[model samples]
Target: MSNPKIFVARLLGLDVFDPLGDRLGRLRDVVVVDRGLHQPPIATGLVIEVPGKKRVFVPMTRVTSMDSGQILTTGLINLRRFSRRGAEQTVAGDLFDRRMVLVDEEGRLEHEHESVLEDLAIERQRNGDWIVTEVYVREVTGRGAFGRARGQHRLVDWDRSRWARGTEPQGATSFVAAHEDLKPADLADMLHDMTDKRRVEVANELQDERLADVLQELPDDDQVQILSHLDIERAADVLEEMDPDDAADLLGELPDNQQELLLELMEPEDAEDVRRLLEYEEDTAGSVMTPVPVIMAPEATVAEAMATIRQTEISPARASLVIVARPPLETPTGRYLGVVHFQKLLRYPPPEPLGNLLDKDLEPVSDLAPVTHVTRELATYNLTCIPVVNEQQRVVGAVTVDDVLDHILPEDWRAMDPDQTPAPSTENPAPTAGGPASARGGAPAAPAAGPTTNRRT
Candidate 1:
């Protein structure tokens, strides 16, 4: 087959084999060395992830052939673990998703302009080494008219654009899309495993909403570490994007002074909810319930309710039931009427008003309800979430089954790698019983989160 220009995204994860056809490992990265300002970087070797351990490298000179099927090596692989030298750059690991500047053909950068390294255009040279000649750069621009803004991609000569200075990468969304399917929890766990400096690098790239979701999944220490790296204003913005309960839990991990500082910097409405959550005992229903959920008026039509759900971007657990209340759907929800479950909405016509379908008899738990009682109530009703109300039956928030599990399960439960099957927990039966409750609507929704890097392409 003729040599085709390949992208870094296409090269990663391909199978590698020896000349004898022995299966070795999957291709992990492409090592390259910059030649000079005139010539683009030249591929030096390939980094491969071995069967069960560290990544290793093989010089391009050892390869007998390279193709989509697999890389046939000369069988002279260097078994030494691959550690990047100061001058070396690896395609997938270092440059694939780096946020960069878009310099026009005249070499001038647009004001506040941003772009990301989508892929590298690698072509084979006569000397047998593949070299990067151009980059697939994607510009972040406003979408035409009504649609959401996004990346506009095109290939460009490598030397035209300079690396963006001091800005965090704008590549997390595209990077996640380029990689295999990833959940927020998975990405958060990966961030936790990285060093603090590395975590900051990745954290800087994510949008506040995505970062908030990942912060919710991470351990308290990791959450605090990431927040510390962000400016107070940005940190507060991220906290506002998070579920109030999750935000409260994270803020609780910080010293009183730091917590107050961030809260002061936050939008008052968002801060009030988190502050209210902080007031409750850690193990109580009030503390665990999310302050933000879909709350609709009893007279809301199914279509209206659906529209509200769409606008909120809430999780399935939060969306499974539309809390019907007396007007003023905001926090301290006016007299709670009942709930219209999502399943019931599907059964009724879209124009049907929720007031008629409200399950008025379903009792709302008090803010003081303990975790044990809360879990039992969820199990008894087969509910993904249950509303918590005050003395006058005003809805405060809803506690999802996952929140209960987070409190009951071992502190390190989320830290465990997903690929490794966890041993059955011998201690608690609450999570075991509540697990199915949380998974009521097929798989629980992944925490909506997203990560990025320095100028590299």
Candidate 2:
């Protein structure tokens, strides 16, 4: 019942428990996630060793906390419930599980970059052997060259394929499909055409990222189908590579059950982000702002701001609009103090303090405030997007309308912009740290950045 305390090292070899306090397995490894901003880490999933040497899987849900010399389980797990990936899923023997992982070595879903094996590739090796089949690689694997050896189908072995069902491309009566391929390009296009179907019939397919990109440009409905159809982990990798907001929006359209399934399947933070946006009304700023913003202290130099932004993993903080704030943001009102459009920040001497060039009269709003107030005030000031302040006046979040139309009122409601707070904005999606950013009622808000912590590789 008390807060569980354990050493990070204990995570390596400690025995893990289920919610029932029953011994489920020994901890095989730890999954570390990197959030661009400083947020607590999440254990994507666990590599567990159950009793009788019957190894099975246990996800974070079955975990309670990491304790000294042990892992607290949810007391609800039984190793019999799930199957674990064994030795065949290795990089040297199993390339299928190695491709999607950015970190971690044994096919555990930890981060986006580490999915090495899911969505396997099909290319002619100079030796004349082709890598036509693969299992969905685990999210974690140590560095090493990987390629599944030739077998009956000449690619993925059935033993591996059964376990990596969703990770590999489906269909085809035989391996001859990819082997007799017209061309990778034509195959890519052909699969794209049937992407909308419940099942795609392809003997050989394009690699994961390439296939994901082609699917992205298709209609929204199509993208969802293809994404959902991929192995859970590989699908997660594609989503991880995508803009969080866009991924969040797309996931929101799915059924609640499916939503949870996909979230459980993804790396923890990515799932949390999607769920976070799902909390806001699809049309509100809460749904639009990427949780990771690059905020700087008003007192800091532009150079400091640049350093912080560059450290970010995905979106570069330096080249975008950077809002000035206090360090470790103590309050919401603190965020509204100033703004420095990216252009203006670059024009000033890097050594100069950001406060020197900031537009100090920052406009902010309570997240719960009517969207109408935001639309009107921003329109009057010719502001692109405004910050959302909390009751304490600390800036918590911002909103935009680049994708969501609900944030922007239709022509019929444009006249009502300046009116008192519109009650309709209160249709609660979820509670946001910053209310929501103002929507686009007229002109667009500046497509700038904030000081949220997100990392891009």
Best by lDDT: 1
TM-scores of all candidate predictions against the true structure = 0.56, 0.44
Runs in model 2 lying further than 4 Å from the true structure: 1-218, 307-319, 329-336, 365-385, 404-457
Q: Quantify all predictions' global Cα lDDT against the true fold.
A: 0.74, 0.48
RMSD to the hidden true structure, all candidates: 20.2, 18.6
Q: Write the per-residue lDDT of candidate 1 for residues 1-457, one digit (tens) a residue.
A: 2553555565567788886789888888888875655678888888987875557888877766666557777788765556554246677767765667866667687546677776776667776667887777778676657653366677777887566776432344234434324678878878888888878767766657778888989988899899999877678878888888899998999999999999997879989999999999878788999887788887789999887766557788888889999877887888888899888888988899999999866677877766666788888899998888876678888889888888766678777665765664434345355543333221100110111122222
Per-residue lDDT of 230 in model 1 = 89
TM-score for candidate 1, please give it: 0.56
- For all candidates, the clash counts are 0, 63
Residues 1-457 of candidate 2: C-alpha lDDT, one tens digit per residue: 2323222222445677655667666765433322212232233455566765543545555555554445776665443322211111212122323232222244343333333333332222344322322233433334445643221112232123222234432344232233343443344345545534422333113334444445434445656767766666556666665566667766876788877777887668767766766776644445565555556677888787767656646344223656677766532324356777766767888899887888866555555555555555566676555665555556655544333334553423322444645454444443344533322111100111211112110
lDDT of 1 at 229: 91
lDDT of 1 at 136: 73
lDDT of 2 at 371: 53
Q: Candidate 2: RMSD over Cα atoms?
A: 18.6
